[model samples]
Target: MLKPWFALCALFLTLGAIAEPSPRQMALFNNNCVQCHLRPGVGAPLVGKAQDWQTRKAQGEDALLRHVVEGLKGMPPLGYCSACSEADFRALIRFMAGMPAGTGQ
Candidate 1:
């Protein structure tokens, strides 16, 4: 009966909920990193600038996590992602690390 429809809707909703980061993490990035790392391209743009992050990643994920959590030159602690959890930062790094440095601004 309608059970299939309900189940389908529930599945979609659950998937959607798990697909993205929390609003707090979003907000933090928006307020902080969004400036330097523009959405499509403008500022430094972290999404696809693999080169930009490659040097950092070379140090290893732990090093990158420490930099993000502790802060670095030109970047404040959490990179302004104040509310981001350690796990959130890790995921964010992994996502950014995958980007190719040559990605257009």
Candidate 2:
């Protein structure tokens, strides 16, 4: 009785914990990436533009992630998303590169 209810609650809690980033995280990504990327001559590659991303993507995902974390020629450290975790950086790279999430190098 109580055990079944507890199990169900645990399952739901686990699922919630593994769910995607909250709206706040999405907003952070948008605020940080969109501002620079969308503008021409910003040096930051525009999101969803394969041509803009090709050369960067050729550098490999690990390199790309390193650039985001450490900052490249024109990109700032943490890609300006100070609150972002490594996973968040990976997602952002994939999103910007126009690659599907979970697609590894």
Q: Could you give candidate 1's per-residue lDDT for residues 27-79 as a string of tens digits?
A: 56556665665434443435445567667668877787897778777667888
Best by TM-score: 2
**Pairs in steric clash, model 1:** 50-100, 50-101, 51-101
Model 1 TM-score, all chains together: 0.58
TM-score list, all predictions: 0.58, 0.72
Candidate 2 Cα outliers beyond 4 Å, as residue runs: 1-24
Model 2: per-residue Cα lDDT at residue 39:
59
What does the lDDT read for residue 53 in candidate 1? 62
